[model samples]
Target: MLNSAYLCGMQKYKVHGALTAVGMIYGVNYSIAKEVMPHYIQPFGFTLLRVGAATFLFWCYHFIHGGESIDIKKNLPRLLLCAVLGVSANQLFFLAGLNLTSPINAALIMTVTPVLVLLSSALLLKERVTAKKALGIGLGLSGAVLLVLQQGESTAQGGMLGDILIFLNASSYGLYLVLVRPLMQRYKAATIVKWIFLFGFFMVLPFGWEEFSSTSWQTIPPLIWLAIIYVVVFTTFVAYMLNAWTLRYVNSSVVGIYIYLQPIFASFTAVLLQQDQLTPQKLLFSLLIFSGVYLVSRK
Candidate 1:
């Protein structure tokens, strides 16, 4: 009854849909996650929860569906670098920044990555940078500065501090993407993920331990517990696994496009939920940011 071509098309559609869902989850997570932090948990402490639980889950999944072995000596150093850049430092800064800033700022600032990637490609990979892309990169950076300057209505302790840290986090993450690009060709996604999180757990221990140890879990609300669970299970694990799976059916550009959708999803979700309001400034700066990203991301 089913045509083979139709079946193939459906499978590809579903895979792309899965990647879009990953972006949506990431977008919505900004508001959902900020609610629990510095109230039910500190940023570093929550990072511990995210990395530790996800690490456990990765290992469990690996055991169930065993994969090829990695060369520890050859791979460990690079994987360790990924852990530090991708998993440990990136999460710590993002959550810490999100805690201090509004979800809208956090979400909008993240969309600047395409420009980051283009620049990184040019500098590191020695790829050609056209004038259009150079202008795109300039627009993205200008938008980021504009984004960080807008004051949120209800801020945590250090809004400026959060903005700075988020840029640092974005930089580190951009470099991680570049650094790991080669290894991705050499290893399975799961294999790389397992080692990255495994090493990342240790890298975060010192920064996260005291806050995690001091957390008064008993005083937290059931909703806070649910938020934490969602961070680990849905935001980290499900989003990432779906992204990896999508690679089988789609190229990196498709995956990257889905990431651009996160801020839209986040901004709309926050506005609809009354957690954040749109301003003339926000609208203008956001357009600048996404416009830049569109130019850089376009083929």
Candidate 2:
């Protein structure tokens, strides 16, 4: 029994690691999008294409895997709310923000999401925000502020529109996570994903037509097409599936903590891809955020 319990614990850790890796891949995909998509597609239009592809792939996966087919009558309200919060609002805010802000600034601003999730969970779910968690939130927020300061003149010159949009993006996603936690618990991940994407597809259809008409399908480079495919497959489908699966075994607050790592991963990827400079201040802030998240999520 002791060894069995130990093995179970190890298995859980492995599963969580896999989920984290999936999240990292999603982050990388977003970084790639930041680099490539803007050259060819408008942000909203790009979102429409990626999400549309993701929706189709997820639907086929559900149908083929013998997963529960979406029952609109039973799940309509939940699906609608998810589509609004998770798909429509979240993506719209993010794409709009990315247009207004530098990718680094956007990434830094988004580190606030875990804190927002904690606060929302505390207010809505009565989840206790212990002293350690509070400290963690403070430390993380401080690190984010430090990062903003470190960016200095460039960030200041970039204006606040992007920053505000990114902030909204973070908040919308946090709320979506909190809102979806229960539904995820009640249904298979694929079922929830299927409905969310289906509703999302419809939500964006009217706005996406111009994009569908204007895009030069034959002229798009193969490498860019490959990036789009990667975003659809690994980032949209697999990443969300892993996130939903992990939520079943963890609390929303705990799962929310993983978001703190996104900026670190994003910065690393930026350095590798863009030859961006890394400074001591950036390293320190990253450490502060990671330490804060550890305190907040520690059992």
The RMSD of every model to the true structure, in order and in angstroms, is 5.6, 3.5
Error of 1 at 266 (Å): 1.3
Q: Which candidate gets the maximum TM-score versus the true structure?
A: 2
Candidate 2 lDDT score at position 58: 87
Local accuracy by lDDT, each model = 0.72, 0.74
Error of 1 at 287 (Å): 9.7
How do the residues 92-178 of candidate 1 rate in per-residue lDDT, one tens digit apiece?
999999988777667656766655655675687565666766676677557645654564433344488887778777777666665
Compose the digit string of candidate 2's lDDT tens values, residues 36-79.
45577767787788779889998898879978645679878978
> For each candidate, what TM-score against the reference?
0.78, 0.88
**lDDT of the structure predicted as candidate 1:** 0.72
The residue pairs that clash in candidate 2, if any, are none
Clashes of 2: 0
